[model samples]
Target chain A: MIVHSASIEAINKDIHPGMVVADATATLPALKVYNYKEGVCEKLLAELADWAFRFTPVIAVEAPDRLLMDISGCPHLWGGEEQYLADVVAKLKQRGYHANAAIADTIGAAWAAVCYGRPGQIIPPGGQQTALSSWPPAALRLSPLILDRMHRLGFYKIGSFINMPGTVLRRRFGQQLLTRIGQALGTMPEQLTSVLPAVIFQERLPCLEPIRTRTGIDIALKTLLEALSKRLLKESKGLRKAIFKGYRLDGNIQQIDIGTNRPVRNVAHLLQLFSQKIETIRPALGIELFILEAPVVEDLSAQQESLWTALGDSDANTELSNLLDRIAGKVGSAAIRRYLPAEHYWPERSMKISHSISEKPDTLWRVDRPRPICLLEQPEKIEVTVPVPDYPPMLFIYKGLIHKVKKQTGLNVLNANGGWISKRRSGITTALKTNRVRGIGYSGRVNMTKETLNGIYMDFLHDSYEAV
Target chain B: MGQATEIQENVVERLRQEILAMQGLRVPLENELRDTGLGIINNAFPNQTFPVAATHEFISDNAQNGAASSGFMAALLRILMCKGSCLWVSTRCRIFPPALKAFGISPDQMIFIDARTSKDALWIIEEGLKCQTLAAVVGEVQELGFTESRRLQLAVETSRVTGLIHRYGSLPTNVTCVSRWRITPVASIGEPTIPGVGFPGWNVELLKIRNGKPGRWQVAWNPDGFKVVQQPKVIEHLPARKTG
Candidate 1:
């Protein structure tokens, strides 16, 4: 077994990490040791990074045991840089954590200052060179090999190489050493990858005491929304979507989100939408913080407001969309749909559903002829008894019910493609079109009449044909 | 003492008569019928027009009957839904949305809610009826009892929105609807020169109307509006089949 880490007291007794456990025990018979568990340090670092978000919006976790925060413009809010650094170190100390914090113009310089200079050091802007001159070469955060090489070359202190020419150093030890020197002296730029993207249109409310009631949550949400809406109004923008997140005392977060059909700046309307979904958030433990964030925002100029009332079409469209949102809140978002007319002859394919209400159809519905108010989902098959060639059915049975036809009207012949070919055709021509006949239109009323009427119609047709 | 008592009674009777006259004047103005654009069919109601801000029940015995009822309801909705959208809550929607175009009601003007059960459908319908923003609420359920119908009526009473309940495959019973209707498909009439089917026709039966006489009419939908068809009398001299 090997010793992975040791405390300060163990180090004082000549016990160090990477030493054989047997030897360490022999050196100090009562030395306490623990087996190292993998990934424990990484997990703790991630947790610390999350906690550090309360201090600044930008936080980057440096592995093993470090966190970098860029509190450039944020420190003034906490009463200046010195007090801000002191406040952070004090808070960590209160939490039983030993931490060192430093502020400088560059990341490398700040890291070096925090590691070697003092517990709390504030390096002035453009003062990295002078501040880092007296530190040891190891304080530059170079690799162990580079530090050892520099020590062997009699460059134990950073001041020893502070005045050296870059060209000479580059020729002697390659570009790495020069680059390290440049980075530590603020000549090189460095970038930090934040743990999460900063949300600009966000407001946070931290409670002095944990709140556990629904009314408390409602009040907190209202306050945050008010503040956020004020900021949005000042910027002349509106949010399309907003999320409310509550941080509980037990380290759990509950969030509820709401979306609007248009960019909304009204807090009351937003609160109404949120009220519908706020019950889903289970506040098992007491909540200590509430945050309202708008990740999706749009530029809402004043001119858009004028267009809303200037045109009647736009007014009705907005009203319809608002109604849809309210109904969706009750039923669901998928329950509502809008359709646009499509260019098709088939009844079912004549119109298509639109994804949103704002879309306009290219073609209007065909109103040339009157269509049925309700078309059967599927055409029902009927048994019809008709005369041989071109006469309408005298009797038909549909859905197990027999109907005697007393009168028949317009005869619309549908072609195979579902298009109406002609309204009326001769009996012989209708026989030819029967092969391609897709549908028949037999719309009329049924009445009980004497059989003598049928004979007269037959006689009349015979007389007309003979005269022609 | 008898004279004083008689004087008090006379004053009370005078006040009562004045109030009755005022109520008589207000009733005609407030309960005026809304023209449904159907000529004689509208006259069949109590006020010679269709009922507005009231609940109407339509019974469908089968799929074909359901189709006919929905079509008739769509035609009524075309006139009612001039300013607001409509809510349609159904257990399973069997009516094709595009078919409503024939009645001049666009699919965009209606929002459909597909509920999981008849109970949920009724709840949604009641909630929709309470919303004044909607012009009308249509619920299609297999069965709706008296209590549920009364609750729906009460909701509409407050919101003043019309409610059309299409009951399918259920026997009609006692309910508090303003009126009840049953529509069945009838043999259509077309000109001999016109080969296609003529306009849609229905045998509209007003089974029960509150404070109005019950009647039946043969109505057909024209492009403009509903036209009442005149029934021809029997004449022995005519042929077995009459062609016009």
Candidate 2:
């Protein structure tokens, strides 16, 4: 591959950019090579702009390693403009970067001086013409084709065309060439778009010394929480999730996080949530700094504390979500569940466990059919004694207890007492209809067939009918 | 002597009233939340009304007893659930939500918290009991000690939410629950000479109650609520006297 960039050491060896890497390595067998990506230069320039924020609040990043800072009145903070420029360049060099900076009356002049004139040069107002005349025509930031055409026309440097009339130069080399010169000489104004960070919800507490005790950490967390909640309360917003981080003196970060089902800004409740997880953090050496970040926030319209605190049905729902949140934090969210009705015939599939506490059921729970309050997880097999043909069981054995069946459906028979005693088919049963129970018993042996018995037989959840 | 005996009776009556008051057993009004469909059984309570925000225990001998207690608890929870939800915390719950509809309680209004361990279930139950937002908390555990039951009582006292504990064993006399009950499924009798298992009926026995009398009642389930079934009037027929 061809060379993309060359260091000062490589340039001193006459290894200019655009030369093949094979030729350069042949010249110096000890040369090191690395691959270059497209956006590396822009990324580095943006980071440099961020670092330069200490110098000026208004800083803009230009592509391909350029930064524009509006230092009109900011230089006095650092002694003077020259020292400021030296300090900036020196700092960049100390970080292993070769940097050139210039201060001029206009942005275009400053850019041209940094690119073409001597390094660390400061130009007086209206002196860009004298300083830039000796540099090449390309220093005006013109296209390569325009520079090639100017070179072919015997114009090698800015001084060659410095005294030419603008109209004549525009006609010969096009308007772009004259426009660049005018912009550099301060004949035109320019706009600089500054980058400023947006406000974030974060609070920090830097301790005077390393804090090693649990009380110290607790105090730090409380202070940060108070500040954060105050700001959130003022903004009519609340935090749904938050993280607390401690910067330990041993260079380790101890972090704990908490989440809420609903938006909450109450410091007391949030502190209680953190208290459940506070013991998990080991403060080892000591904590030097603490930071709390609200990663998730939501809008909760403000209401008076007394109004919400008053007992009401709506407030009960709110308090319930908070209570569930606290319980979930202790035993995980999976341990808690709400149920909704599912339109299924099987009892197991008739209801489903719901994760959301406030979800509405699609199908109504069937009240027409009777269902058992406590269904056996597994079907239980018991012993039954059928007294006669086409008749309900007379006695059943469940859990080794002889529970004599009291109700008989059809074919009424007398017990030893002979009082027209019928083993009552479970009357008012959750599984049977009232009329069906009456019809089977009062109709007198007409519907006592095997098929009808199986219908009542299938309702195992109703009672100990499985024994029958 | 008669006058002295009258004075002693007056003092004893006053002492009883004082004890009832200290137990927080003031009689509730007729139109309040004390209507638990218990009929005459409600009078057996200390205040002649069903207690709310108090701990009740149900002891079961086996699976049949367990099911009966669950049904009875669900019936009570139905009355307590007034636009509020109930938490059924247990190791593994087998109650069918759709079946709760028969008790006049919509299944969607109930939350089931299944814990992997009985201890976790107890913790969840205590937490739910302490939350004033819930209507009631039903905990089905294998066992609970005297101190644990006392802790649960304290939680309900502050939150004013009822707590129901179900266990498959003998009752604990030293527990701090306000009342203890045992329910057994009784054979159902059809209405008006119709034969079959009519409404699901149970033999509800209040074994012990604080500052109240223990009694037994036969209750049957209806879509509306509990119906107290009267004892059957069985007239004895004279055995034939002509054996000689």
Candidate 3:
């Protein structure tokens, strides 16, 4: 014996176009073709809200595989409720799913019909028990343990359970089981616990005729942006980057993605950002539908000062970032990188190149230091003859250029706190020390007895002495 | 015989000067350069404020379409609009009207010329550079060939204006532009008030400067604008010691 939940929609007694919705098990998946536990089944159905939209926008997936859709005025698009149910079943089968759908006047009767009654039964407003009594106990979607106990009690079918004293059933299985049965049979009102609904961020442009030209695509995109901008503004959200996908009658998706350095909800600004890239997309075979979706949205308060406004117009930084975004979009973001000073002392390892958005140059990064006029990416080992261990070399060759030190300088370290270091997989740790010894063959080693020799730290300070 | 020797001597002097000037010239350390000007960013840029004559050159290697050139130019145009008016010659990517608006740059201030070929792009850039009334000229091309760079360089010198050729990642060849730069994002500064805050700054290397040493520099980019500072001081070349 199995128990199944039911669903129904009723016009509000007070409001003209308002409706009341009820579901016995809103989180449960519709059916158990696959063995999913009651709790896990509920979770899985909740995640399928996006996919459930195929039936109705007002769809709520009941526990297990059941879904209650308030299709009051929605089914005319599918040519009425019976045809709608058939079409839904066909579509689900195409997507590798099995479902039982029914239409009824009360939520409880609809649940009974879909679970135990035949696939096509339509329960008129007051016919809940007439439709539900003949179904098996298993149709109620109750816990198998409870269903087995009810069977052992000799109440094997839904009609038997209905005929037995409701008081005796309550005294036997706890109140929830009987209440679920009563709710499915229209004896009690059912309540649904709603899940997080799918977020609909798409802006659609349905062209009366196919758009084949770049200009036409531009017009369609502009129309969509205008519409979407208003929605985003109303939501106090801004789009930073969006993908514009064009759908051809042949079902091919042509997508072009555009990005904004800052989140924008202004229609004009959004239009200008995409104008050039739109030419890159050929209408190939023509597009009949256009959809713009912003995958990333930011909380945008229009009152917040624009970066340009905050900087007060004396800065080129905003302009430069916009340029970087454009270049990164075309040549790949990796091609444009800013040099960030690393914590290591090694010349080659002292700097790292990261994507333009990661590290920002601050006032402290500009602190002065004695850096080689021309620092090679990698230090080339050169043969040098020093007068002694602690003396600056009179002459040294680098890249085959021998330059005599006009003024000699010993190591000097600029003391300051390191700026923000981002999380990367493997690199120099920020806590590492830097040791710089500038004299010829300068070597300073810490005592091994101090603790542990994790790694070497070198900091070069400006040491200037006259070369003899 | 005297005239021929004199001509050879003059050529030698010029070549020597060029080499010496190319080597060891450091960009002047002007603390004020980062400031640019006051009231310039907020009032001028979005309103198309800068005059055309104050433009600067932007160099990228590949002039091809969909290369970083247009993006590079757009960013600069965004900056130039901070100060004045701008004309952009787009050879590679199609200009979308909506994207420009999204960036907050006035659509009315921008005139986009689509050049079918690289030759046409260079010619347009050269002409735009010569116009004193425009704030900047961005030439979108696939390759700013040596000859093309020389011609554009001459135009920049004559107009006393900036002309940027948007190129790809390839380093510039023998052709000299006023300044060679690559736009990369600097590490954003983390803020105590705000968790992850980096107002986009650039690690700008003066790859080739007429009067500046080619060293790495960092500049913070804010909506207010770009501000340059010296690159962070780090320990110079030192060998890693082998630990026992």
All candidates' lDDT scores?
0.70, 0.73, 0.52
Please report how far candidate 3 places residue B45 from its true position, in Å: 28
Model 1 Cα lDDT, one tens digit per residue, B196-216:
445666667877666445577
Of models 1 and 2, which has the larger DockQ? 2
TM-score of 1: 0.56
Q: Residue-wise lDDT of candidate 2 within B99-121, one digit each (tens)?
A: 67777787788888778887888
Task: Report the TM-score of the second chain of model 2 against its true counterpart.
Answer: 0.82
Worst 10 residues of 3 chain B by lDDT: B42-51
C-alpha RMSD over true interface residues, each candidate: 8.8, 7.0, 19.6
Rank list by lDDT:
2, 1, 3
lDDT of 1 by residue, A309-340 (tens): 46576666655555555556666666666667
TM-score of chain B of each: 0.80, 0.82, 0.60
Scored against the native two-chain complex, candidate 3 gets a DockQ of 0.04
Model 3: lDDT of residue B115 = 59
Model 2: CA > 4 A from native? A1-201, A304-306, A344-346, A360-362, A375-468, B1-14, B23-33, B169-173, B191-198, B230-244
Off by over 4 Å in 1: A1-200, A299-319, A368-468, B1-33, B130-133, B145-147, B230-244
TM-score of chain A of each: 0.44, 0.43, 0.45
Question: Candidate 2, what DockQ?
Answer: 0.32
For model 2, what TM-score does chain A reach? Answer: 0.43
